[model samples]
Target chain A: MRTILFLLQKEFIQIFRNKTMLPIIFIMPLVQMLVLVFAANLEMKNIKMKLVDFDNTATSQEIVSKFKASPFYNIIGYSYSVEEAQNSLIDNSADLVMVIPPNLEQDILNGQSPKVQLLIDAINGMTAGLINSYSSMIMLDVNKDIAIELMKFSANQQLKQISIKQRFWYNSGLNYKHYMVPGIIVILVTIIGMFLTALNIVSEKEFGTIEQINVTPIRKYQFILGKLIPFLLVGLFDFALGLFIGKLLFGVPIRGSLFLLFSFAFLYLVLVLGIGLLLSIISDTQQQVMFLTFFITLVFVLMSGLFTPIETMPLWAQRVNIINPFAYFMKVNRMILLKGSGFFDLIREFLYIGIYGIISIVVAIRLYRKTS
Target chain B: MKALEVSHIYKTYNDITALKDVSFNVAEGELFGLIGPDGAGKTSLIRIIITLLLADSGEIHLLGKDVVKEYKYLRSRIGYMPGRFSLYSDLTVLENLNFFATVFGTSIEANYNLIKNIYSQIEMFKDRKAGDLSGGMKQKLGLSCALIHKPEVLFLDEPTTGVDAVSRKEFWEMLQELKQKGITIIVSTPYMDEAEMCDRVALLQKGEIMSIDTPQNIINEFSEELIEIKTPDLYEVKEKLRLEFGKNSAFMFGQSIHFSTSSKSKSKELLNEFFEENNFNIESVNIIEPNIEDCFIKLMTKDS
Candidate 1:
């Protein structure tokens, strides 16, 4: 225990000695928080639109007003003909377009819905899809207003209906920063906390310290545990800083128990740090550790389902994601923060992550014995 | 009980045999030396005794405890300063010393007297990071860290290889002080001069022991008269001797050369005549006593 503390203190001092690491440790997360909260938004808004009006009537002008008045579209330009509208689209001047033919008012007055053309550019496929859907929403509102006007003229009791209401669960405002910042925090902790310790140890060995320590009375477990535990603390410190930034800068709500999130984050850091210890034991050089850890972290984060939902992955990829600890941690973070889940909700993930930590410490200790 | 004992210690890495049927023992309080050139298996043998490595077929006992089975107990009684400087570079001298002491379940104050003599020289820079220290200071700190627990056996592997001359002298003087306290020491060195300082020395080559005895006794085994010859054309003389007497007659020593032979009387007169004929000045020529280097070369050549 004393040896572990001594080593831990030494490691921390070394970390703080590198003046460049201080700013990165403290300020980088807050900077990321600020930039990402405002810049990382995935919400679809402020759409640019063009119009092609062939009808040139009052009805066409009223429909165009419906689109412009709605906050979704800012009418950039209007084309007198379809050729001009095509040129507008080719020049990327607008993301959406409205076409009103000459017979639009006559068709609707005759009790037949007007077959107006709605052109949407699907170049940025997902965003284009949202813009298309939003424009159709405006058209629906126009139809409802016309229906209400006509219903006043003719009394139809069957057409008197009440409105259906909706309430967004959990995140009522659909805040993007609330979700993205926490996930980014988890990823930063993984990269900075775990890999640096392993690379440092490997560098010492390459520089010849392991051989020196081998002859000393330092137990294999003590040596490795000393290297790992301090880095684990650093990771937790970073985690706390990230959480603080998430709350202070982005106003990301922590609906779940903070203690629960802290517990899982600590356990998950143990798992990551254990893997770092194992990497240090197996690798003989810093370059090797850095290269191998880079590959492992890349694979872990890609399938972690942080940016994308795990439900959308194919079956085989989902199976691969099950073995990834980052994937489990990502789920734990979202469930705990966004959904206000209790311990029982993360019981299975917590157990597997705990098991992984135990196995890694055991395997790393075994490797130290044989390889030393 | 013996401080160290080994039997049939054979170690092979892939296909190369590092140690073959190697066996030796060091009595308690003896400063035994393993003297040889590079790659003579001295390191492999030290590593086994320190429990960093295991021999394929052998039993090693340190202080009457099995090295492999009782590694933890044996480690507590051993202090090892490896050939390379392996102290924590980012840490200050104090931190490294305290850390190593803590690892052995002891404190620096408890073992301060043991390392005090050596540590005092480098004490001025206790706060300086070890990475910035000079080579001599590093070796001192490494020794201090190793001795912080006051182990019974002190194992130094080529501790003076890259050190300056004065520091080497100071290091040996400190070893003498440790020896006065009845600590058993086993130091390996390739420097032949260091062999005479030990209680007993073994000349090893290619994982095989060539000679094991005191320095005087090993030198007594040299069966040739060594003469250092300097001629106008030294290369011509060496070639002439190699051409005439084949391999056994000539061996290079520094700028001049040593001719090792049992019949130097017959060759001495011929050499003078050749020198007089060649108009080379006979500044100095005399039969010299055999040092460890000469003794080692003779042992190696006699066996081959």
Candidate 2:
């Protein structure tokens, strides 16, 4: 709309002219990209593990050797007693502990499986869970070694049958930045568009200029569009910059169609811009806007499955993601850049985001126009 | 034709009745004023007329268009400047004007003449951010933005509450000039002196219209005998006056005691006797005409 264009132009001017907000928006994304790309990873190449080997047998030593050989875990220190192991865990000197009881070699020769305890600090549920799974798998290999030797001597046992079709579809390697950069871009656009616009509008109302605009012959749609356009443009500009940096720095690929990325991004911007306007209308001051903005964005980003797979989230959060525009775009961004998904691949998301955009704009305009 | 009209408007924010059965109208090309102190529903009523807010129960017509129904139409016809300076602080004076003008499907050049008188003052600092402007300059900039669209109605809600005295004076002068240009102006202010500036004023108290007429007519309705009596010990003298001659509202207006009496005949000997009884020296005593502030006090007393 013409009103939308005017609003967009005004928003761009404010973002450019406002000295306090320009750097916060323009520079912070790049800075965060640099920090996060290095900081975020699931590979866990250097986890410090402690060994409390009470048995000191060949088998126990072999188990420790196998753990140390894997790229995921590293044996950092040794402890003799449970107290020392617990102390190491509490002090975060070790992430995991392998405790072997005495006479473990005798028990394995007596045809009894020696019980080994793996104490893991589950406080950081993600890393702890991953470490536990890896530790369990390594134990299976040790048990197989014991079984193979026993089987050759006795000739009584049979090998078990296990089948797993582990096919990693889109990102087989699971490069952290491949998964991380796209989702981060989604959240980045969301933060810039929603919070910044909310701040800009509430600041006007706080200063009493909202009343001046309210009295104008300008339509409510114009006012709402005016509030939206600048942030949307800034959001898009930031989007391109983030995309460029992702390509140049991290070597992220944009496999998705550029048209599809821009199209859905435009739709998502509309949805978020409506939300920003709604927030501005509901808030009495800029402080409230900022607080609520932070809260909403936190919820949106977390629920978007930026950290965990959407398949891993609880059904409730997964359902809520349907309403979250970022959830869809996080997928779209990944599909487009990492997976090189086409327009047809993201058609459903594009439709939903468009619908969300239209509904939100309508509701925000209807509710906000009254305050004019 | 009526430029603006409201009939039996009742607006309540929960338990607080901001406007109750309030009705008033402004004729075409008239400068009407809603004069009241803070919390008198001045802003609320102005917001409704501007179509930025809606009345809980009322019929409002702006330029013969229904405010609630034809809101979009109403908005295009009215210009509002709220009590507080609400402009884009980051934008310069010119940017604010141009942005607003663009919204109305018009360019600043198209409406520049309408705001030429007020805009010229701040035009030199068009590049300076609005946040850095002086209060007077901000006020002028707000006026320019509101007038840039050249709406049929201009609703100014306490536009001069915090500006300096000279700025306030200049603002009223500008209003007078705008009135001559056939813009129906509805100005609200808490300042009693400003009440006289409007062609007519409606004194509101507790969300109700107490009185409405020309400023002189409202003052002329003051039937009580008002006198300002000062004594060396004014507090002591006021107590004595309240005891003897304060059956009518006796209150302090600055250093003097302004108290009314049932009749002028009862006041002749009482002021001197009250001061003597209170053991005070009389520096001055004279009969004075009631101003809008006094009328408002009287109205608030009656409402209470």
Candidate 3:
């Protein structure tokens, strides 16, 4: 343990003394948290919708007004013909074209359901799907109004109609930034833990200092632990800074216990640090470590449900995410911060991350040879 | 017991052989030197003995323990300075020294007597970054760090390769002081003059040992008489002499030709007659004693 303390002291001195790396370590995460939270938003807003009302009726105008009032749609233009609306959509002026039938009010008054055609631009498939669902909700509300009026006139007070109401439990306002801040914070911690440890060891190799250390009586496990503990501390520090920024800038509430969040972060950092050390052990130069870390981190980040939901991904992608530690942490961060999840609720994630940390560290130890 | 013992050690990298059936031994408190040129397996041999590298097949015992099996125990007792400047360049001199001492489970205070002579030279600038120090200062720091643990044996690989001549002299003086403290030092260098500083030297070449003995003994073992011939055109004199006495005996040595032959009297008589007949202006011709460089050249040429 004394030997480990010495090694850790050396590592910290080297890390802080490096002029180029000091700013990167202390300030890069804050910049990423501030910028990425705004850029990585998933909420679909200001969807441009064009109206092609052929009926010129009260019901059609009411539906159009509802869409315009919901804050989700921007009425770009009103077209007299379906062809004109199609032109507007083709010119990128509108994303949704709503064509109401000529007898929309007449059909409703005669107690017959009317048909409406919605021409949606599916270029962004996810956004198109959302627009479709929102437009259908507005039409359903108009139908409910007609049905209630008809039921009162017919004196059918016992008529039954089923209506579904939605209540967003955790994020009532559906703010994308609130959900994204915690996930981005997870990414920041991951980048710091993995990149720094890998570069640290590889730089030692480049400078040929490992040979001097290798010849000493320091045990391999002791050396590995010494390297891991310093970076783990740095990672936790970065995580705390990210959380502070998340709360200060975005006003993201931490509903869960702070202690629970930190303990889980500690476990997750061990996993990331193990991965970084393994990468360093396999690489011979700092440049190789940098490139490999970049490629692997990119893969983990893109597939870790940081921006998209893993459940909606293909089966193959979801299967690959099982080994992605970032995916597990991203999920747990949201669960704990947004849903007030407790320790027992994250037992499975803790188990997987712990096992991964153990396995990666074991492989790193096995591959790191004292003799060459 | 011998401080270091190796028999029939061999090492290879890929298809290239680095150390071939090599063997040597150093007695306790002896200053041993492995003298050879670059790529002559000097660094490889030193690394293998220090347990930083593995020998393909061999036996190595240091301080009466197997180097491979008891490496952990041996490591605490041996100090190694690799061929390159391996200390952290960004760290201060004192920090680097303190780190190595602490890792060895010892304190700088414990080993102060051993490294004081060397460390005191650079102690004033102990706060300077190691990379910012001069080449000589860096070597001093390297030596100080290596000796910080007060190991039983010190392995320095080419400690003076790029150092200035004055610094090199000072470094050997420091080593001599350490020898007085009964610390066995094994140093390797390509500079042939350093062989004379060691009690015994092993001359290595192309993964093979050319000779292992005291520098004076190696010089005394030269069987041929060495003749130094100077002339206006040394290259021409060399070619003519090679023609007369064959290529094995004649070599160029800085504006003079060293011609060796079995019969000195006959060679002298022939050199004067041959130069006169060839219309060459002879400057001086005398018999000179051979040094380690001459011995190594002879040994390498003989082996080839």
Candidate 4:
């Protein structure tokens, strides 16, 4: 235990003495959090729309006015021809186009339903889908107003209709930043925990200091635990800072118990740092460790459902994520912060990560040999 | 009991043999040297004995403990300074020293007297980072760190390989002081002249031990008469002499040529007559004593 304390003292001195690495540890996470949360947004607004009205009648004009009043649509201009409206879409100036046919009022007065054609740019499938839904909702509102007016004129007192209402439960406003900040915090914690520990031991190998330590009386478990504790503290500190930034800058809610969140974060960091130690043991150079960690963390972060929902991914990808610790952390982070999930709700993730941490550390220590 | 004992040690990397059937013993309190050039298996032998590397097939007993089986207990009883500068360069000198002392589960105050002779030289620069120190100072710090634990045996691999001439001499003097304290020291060096400082040395070459004995005894064992000849055209004269006396007989030593002959009498006269026939400008010729390097070359040539 005294030997481990000495090792920790040495490691901390080396870590803090590195002037270049200080900023990378403390400031890079803040910059990433402030930038990625806002930049990675998928919410659609101000969709550029083009209106084509063949019937220059009052009803068609009223419909065009209704679209103009909506906040989601930005009408660039009116086109007299359908082909001209399509040219706007092809030129990338318009995201959506609505065509009101001629005799649209005559068909309505004759109790015949008319068709309104919508020409939407389907290049980006998600944005095109949003535009289609928004335009359809506006058209439905116009139909309702027309139906009520016609019912009053015909003295039909009994008209039956089924109306559906939606209320988003957790994220009422559907703010993308709220959903992204917690996930980005997972990434921040992972980078600090994994990359630093991975590079630390490999640098010692490159410098030949590890050989000196290996020849000492220190046991393998003592040496490995000595390396683990300092970085674990640093990882937790980075996690706290990330949480503070998430709450301050993005107004990300922390509805769950802070104690439970931190306890789980501690476990998650151990798993990450354990893997880092394992990589360092197998690699001889800092460059090799860096490449290996980078490749692995890249795969984990992408499959982590940070940018895309894991449920919507292919079945094989979802299966692969069962072993991805980042995915577990990302899900738990969102659950605790946004959904206020309790400890019992995240019991499975806790058990898997804890088991993974213990196994990786054991394997790392077992694979580390004092002799070469 | 012997401080270190090895019998028929062998080690190989892939298809290349590093140490082949090598064996040596160091008595307690003896200052021993493994003298050889680079790639001569000096480091390999030292590493195997120190428990930092495994031998292919051999038995090594350090302080009567099996090196492979009792490595964990033996580690605390031995100190090693590898060929490279292995101290933490980013750490201050005192911090590096203190850290190693703590790692060995001892305090500097407890072992302060052991490293005082060496550590006091750089005591004023204790606050300076090790990486910012000179090469000689870095080596001194490494020695101090190794000695901080007061191990029974100390292994130094090429400690003076890159040090300055003055620092190299000082390093040897320090080793002598440590030897007086009765700690067995096994140091490896490529410098043949450094062998004279050791109580005993094993001249190693191509993964084999050429000879093992005291420096004086090894020098006295040279049975052939050696003649040194100086000429203006040294290379030309050397090549001519090689053709006449065979390749292993004549070699360039410094600015002159050393020619060895098994013919005891009138060898110098024969060499003078040969130089005269070749129209060589010979300054002079005289019988000279053989040094360790000469003995090594003779053994190497004889073996090949």
Candidate 5:
């Protein structure tokens, strides 16, 4: 235990004494969080609309006004001809084009259905789908209003209607930042924990100091524990700092117990830092460690369900995510912050992540040879 | 029991054979030197013996325990200074020293007597970063760190390779002091002069030990008479001598040419007549006692 303390003391001194590492460890994560949270947004808004009204009728005007009132669309212009609307779509002035037939009011007055055409640019599939859904919703509203007026004067009226209301749970507004903040915080902690510890022991190898340590009487477990504890502490510290900044700058709330979040963070950091140590032990230089760590972090972050939903991914990818510690942490972060989940809700993740930590630590110790 | 022993140690890296059936031993409290040039298996042998490397085939016993099976037991009793300066450069001298000491389950005060003579020289600047120190200071710090555990056996591999001449001399003096304390030291160096400081020396080259004996004994055993010849055109004369005698008979030695032959008088007479005939101005021609370096060259040439 005393040996571990001495090693920890030396490691902390070296980390704190390095002038370049100070800003990298403490300030870079917060900067990344601030920029990525606001930049990486998936919400679609400000869709440009071009109107082609062949019917000089009240129903046509009402449909156009409904689209104009909604925040999702911008009415670029009212086209006199279908060619003008097609020209607007071609010249990039509009993303959506709506055409109402000449007899829209006549058809409604005669108790017949009138067809509407909505032309959407399908180049970006996601935005196109959203635009189509929004346009259909507005057209449905117009048809319901027209039908209700017709039914008001009928004496043999036996009409029944069912209305469905949607209430989004947890995130009532469906704020993207609220979901993104926790996930980004998970990435920040992983970067600081894995990258630093991966480079730490390898830098000692480059400097030739490891030889002096390797020849000593220290046991391999003691040495590994000594290396692991310092970086674990540093990783946890960075995680807490990120949480504080998330709360302060983005208004990200921790709906669950702070103790549960932190305890899981500590375990997750062990799993992360253990993998770093294993990389350090296997790699011969700092450059190799950097490249390998970057490659793995790229894969891990993309598939960890940080930016996209895991349920939407293919079945094989979800199976691969079972081994990713980052995925577990991302889930736990969202569950605790967004769902107000307790430790019981996260017990399966906790056990799996804890088992991974033990396995990684054991493999790292096995690979780290005192003699080579 | 012998302090250390190696019986038929062999090590290879890829296709290159680093040590070829090498064997040697050092008695308790004796200072032994492994003298060779770079790439001569000195570092390979030292690493194998220290348990930092595994030999392909060998048996090594250190302090009456097998180096492979009992490495953990021997780790605390042996100290090693690698070929390069291996101290933590980011750490202050005092911090590095304390760190090594603490890892060995002791304190600096416990072994201060062992490293005092060497450590005190850099004590004033103990707060300075080790990387900022000069070469000599780094050497001293490496030595101090190696000795901080107060081990019975010290293995120093090329400790004075990059040190200045004055520092090298001081380092040897410190080793002599260490020897007086009854600590067995095994040191390797590329410099031949360092061989004289050790009680016994092994002349190694190309993964083979050409000779192992006291430095003076090896020097005296150099059978051929050594003659130093200098002239205005030294290179031309060396060429002519190489043509006259075999190529191995003559070599350049620090501004003079040294020639070795069994019939010294006959060769000297013939060389004088040749220089006169060729109109080569001769500065001096005299026979001097062979040094350890001269013996090393002679043995290597004879072996090949």
Candidate 6:
């Protein structure tokens, strides 16, 4: 135990003495939080639209005015020629173009459905799909109004309709930042916990200091724990700072118990640091550790549902995420912060991460040799 | 009991053999040296004995404890200073020393007397970072850290390989002092002069022990008479001598050429007549006593 304290003291001194590392530890997380939360948003707004109406009627004018009033579409201007509107789409000036053909009011009055054409840019498949849906909904509303008005004048009968209302359960406003902030916090803690621990021992190996330590009476467990505990505390501290930034900057709600959130975070950190230790044991130099950790962390973050929904991914990918530690924490972070999930709600994640942490650490200790 | 014992130790890395059937023993309180150039398997042998590396097939008994089977208990009883500067460079000198002391489960206050003579030399710079120290000072700090635990056997691999002459002298004196405290020291170096300071040394060359004995005995064991030829053209004289008498007979030693031959009486007369016939200016030619280096070259060439 005394040996471990000495080792811890030595490690902490080295960690703090590194001038370049201090800023990375304290400031990089806040920068990542501020930048990635706002930049990684999928919410689309201010979609530029060009309207080409051939019919100079009140019905055509009403549709143009409705498109202009919606918050999502930014109407560029009215074009008389359909060819000119299509040119705007080619030049990327407009994301969508709506062309109403001639005789649109006469066709509705004569009980004929007039063709309303929408030309949308399909470069980004996702945004194009959203634009199609929004424009279709607007047209549907316009059709219903005309039908009701025509019925009132023709016959004294009321039209029966079924209206649907939507209420978003957790994120009422559908704030993308609120959903992203917690997930970015998971990434921040993971970077600190895994990268630092992975590079720590390998740097000693490069410096030839580990050989000196190997000859001493210090047990393997003491050495491993000494390395693990300091980074664990640093990771937790970074996690807390991330939580504070999430609450203060993004106004992300922390509805669940803070204690339960931190408890799971501690377990997840252990699992991550354990893997780092395992990497360090297998690697011989800092460069090897850096490349290995970078590759693994990149895969973990990308497959973790940080940017995309895991359910929407292929079936094999979802199965692969069962072993991804980052996915578990990314899910639990949102669950506790957004949905107000309790300990019992996250029991399965807790069990898997706990078991993973034990296995990795035990394997690390078993592989570490005093003599080779 | 012997401080260290090895029998037929062998080690290899892939196809490259590092130590080949190497064996030696160090008595208690003896200052032993493993004298060889780089890649002479000096570091490999020391690492195996200190329980930092495994031998391919061998039996090593350090203080009567099996090195492989009982490494855990033996680790506390031994101290090793690797060839590289292994102390924490980012740490202060005092912090580095204190850390090693604590790691061995002992305080500096407990082992203060053991490292005092060496530690006091750099105690004034205790606050300085180890990386900022000079090469000599770094070596001194490494030695101090190794001695802080007061182990039964201390293994130092090339402690004076890159140190200045004055500092190298001082390091040897410190080792002698440590020997007086009843700690067996096994130090390796490529400098032939340094071998004279050890009580006994195993002259190693290319993964094999050439000879093992006291420095005087190794020198006395040179079977051939040695002749030192001083001339203005040293390289030419060496080449001429090698062409006349085989490749292993003549080699450059510092400022002169040393030629070894079985016939001491006739060789000097023959060399003078030959130099005169070749129109070469000879400064002096006299039979000289062989040093450790001469004995090493003779033994190394004999094997090939």
Best by TM-score: 6
What tens digits encode model 5's per-residue C-alpha lDDT throughout B107-150? 99999999999999999989999999999999999999999999
Candidate 2 per-residue lDDT, tens place, A1-372, comes to: 776777777777877776778897889789878887778776666778889999998988888899989998878888798898888999998898889999998899897877999899989899998888888999988888888777877876676757466878677766788788888888888888888878877887777666666656556676776777677878998899889889999888887688878988899999998888789879989889988888988888888888888898889888998898888999888888777888887789989999988998898877875453
- Local accuracy of candidate 6 as per-residue lDDT tens digits, A156-240: 6999899889999899999989899989999999999999999988998999999999999889999999999999999999999
Clash numbers, per candidate: 0, 8, 0, 0, 0, 0
List candidate 3 segments past 4 Å from native. Answer: A50-63, A78-121, A142-160, B229-250, B261-265, B268-285
Clashes of 2: 8
State candidate 1's DockQ: 0.52
- Which portions of model 5 miss their true places by more than 4 Å? A51-57, A78-125, A146-159, B262-265
Best by DockQ: 6
Enumerate residue pairs that collide in model 4.
none
DockQ of 3: 0.79
Error of 5 at B13 (Å): 1.3
User: lDDT per residue, candidate 4, B1-304, as tens digits?
Assistant: 8999999999999999999999899999999999988999999998899889999999999999999999998999999999999899999999999999998989899999999999999999999999999999999999999999999999999999999999999999999999999899999999988999999999899899989999999888898898888888899998887787788888998899999977788998898889778788989999998887788788778956
RMSD of 5: 2.4
Candidate 3 displacement at residue A100 in angstroms = 5.7
The lDDT for every candidate, in the order shown, is 0.83, 0.83, 0.90, 0.92, 0.90, 0.92
After superposing candidate 4 on the true structure, give the runs of residues whose Cα lies further than 4 Å from its correct spot: A52-63, A80-91, A97-124, A142-159
Clashing residue pairs, backbone N/CA/C < 3 A, model 5 = none
What TM-score number comes out for model 4?
0.95
DockQ of each: 0.52, 0.54, 0.79, 0.84, 0.81, 0.88
lDDT of 2 at A83: 90
Provide the global lDDT of candidate 2 against the true structure: 0.83
| Candidate 2, B-chain TM | 0.94
- B27-129 in candidate 3: lDDT tens per residue? 9999999988899999999988988888999999999999989998999999888878999999999999999999888889998988988899899999999
Find the number of clashing residue pairs for candidate 5: 0
Model 1 CA deviation exceeding 4 Å by range: A46-67, A70-129, A135-164, B232-240, B262-264, B274-283, B301-304
TM-scores vs. true structure, each candidate: 0.89, 0.87, 0.91, 0.95, 0.94, 0.97
Which one wins by TM-score: 1 or 2?
1
Question: In model 3, which residue pairs have backbone atoms overlapping below 3 Å?
Answer: none
Task: Give the clashing residue pairs of candidate 2, or none.
Answer: A7-A226, A8-A229, A208-B86, A209-B86, A209-B87, A255-A340, A256-A336, A372-B52
